[model samples]
Target: MSDAWQHWAGFMADLAAVLLSLTAAALIPILSVRALRYLTARRNDHQRETLHRIASEAAALAEAAFADGNGPRKLSLAIGYAQEQCAGTGITASADTIRAAIEKAVMDYNAMVKPWSGLPAPGAIAKPKGESYSQ
Candidate 1:
């Protein structure tokens, strides 16, 4: 009985050692790659999420400004904020140009829009800016 118990113990110890070595071998690179992927994905996701939230907020602000009929002043402020965000996102327009661009945006927004109406016109997407409005 004692001999049988010793054999079982030896077998168990060998299995445990093998398992530990296998786990160690598998764990090192797997943990490293998982950590690297998690960090990279987190950074990219954070940047993308921030940009998406900013765009949503800007759109809401512009829509509210338009809805409240706050006139050119509120819209101008909204456009200015949008322009700053665009520049932050690597767009190349300066604030002065962006201001003019905002005016064009406002014109486009004003066109095909009825301040009192509830429906959007066909194919009437709000442009970031419009050159044709000034020309």
Candidate 2:
């Protein structure tokens, strides 16, 4: 009877150990995936911020270039600037991607301004050639 009881106790201990090992093995992949997701989210947030900043700067530069009548040159410079900014921010986007993003930003800005363009101010009146300032 004592021999049978000892065998039963040994079997229970081995079973518990095996269950613990299996549990650990199952948790490993779950934990690894969670960590990878966290890291990827952080990287995405950084890239997003970098892209926003680059788009804004490119728009400003493009506007200046357009105003100066050197649209092509300015657009090229904006692209170069974006590439430099991407490198600085650890973004790996290609030049073409950056250029496209900048162009889209500029186009959106132009479209946004087009609505109120060439209109006079609300309270201002245009003066004729012979109009007198004081009446």
Candidate 3:
């Protein structure tokens, strides 16, 4: 009876070892993939936020140029300034696309006006020097 019990205990120990090995083999790849996905998502979010900041800077510069009466050169100057700003901050984006988007935003703002506001067509100048809109 003592010898039989010893053999059973050894077998149970071997089984436990095999089960632990299998669990590790199955779990390692799953955990690695999940970690990779989390890192990729974080990188994407950072890139997105950087792009948003660049776009905002571009739009604001274009609006300021317009308000300064830059005429047809407002969008182009804004794009150039935005590209330089992005380069300064190490952000990557297309200058032409940024220019086009700023142009559209300026035009849209110029074309639309609320009826009850009693304000003139402000064009791209959403906030003038003393205007509190931007502040």
TM-score-based ranking: 2, 3, 1
Give every collision pair in model 3.
none
**Count of backbone collisions in candidate 2:** 0
TM-score of 3: 0.56
- Could you tell me which 10 consecutive residues in candidate 3 have the lowest summed lDDT? 107-116
Model 1 / residue 108 / CA error / Å:
13
Off by over 4 Å in 2: 1-14, 116-135
Cα lDDT of model 2 by residue, 1-135, tens digit: 999999999999999999999999999999999999999999988897778679779778767767866778878888888888888878988777788888888877877889677678966967776777675
**Ten contiguous residues with the weakest lDDT in model 1:** 51-60
Clashes of each: 0, 0, 0
- Give the CA lDDT, 0 to 100, for residue 9 in model 1: 100
Which parts of model 3 are misplaced by more than 4 Å? 69-72, 88-90, 95-135
| Winner by TM-score between candidate 2 and candidate 1 | 2
Give the Cα RMSD of candidate 1: 12.8
After superposing candidate 1, which stretches have Cα over 4 Å from the reference?
58-135
> Residues 27-135, candidate 3, lDDT per residue (tens digit)?
9999999999999899867865665666666666767657767666766777777677768877666766666656665554556644435556667446657766555
What TM-scores do the predictions have? 0.37, 0.65, 0.56
Positional deviation of residue 24's Cα in model 3 after best superposition, in angstroms: 1.9
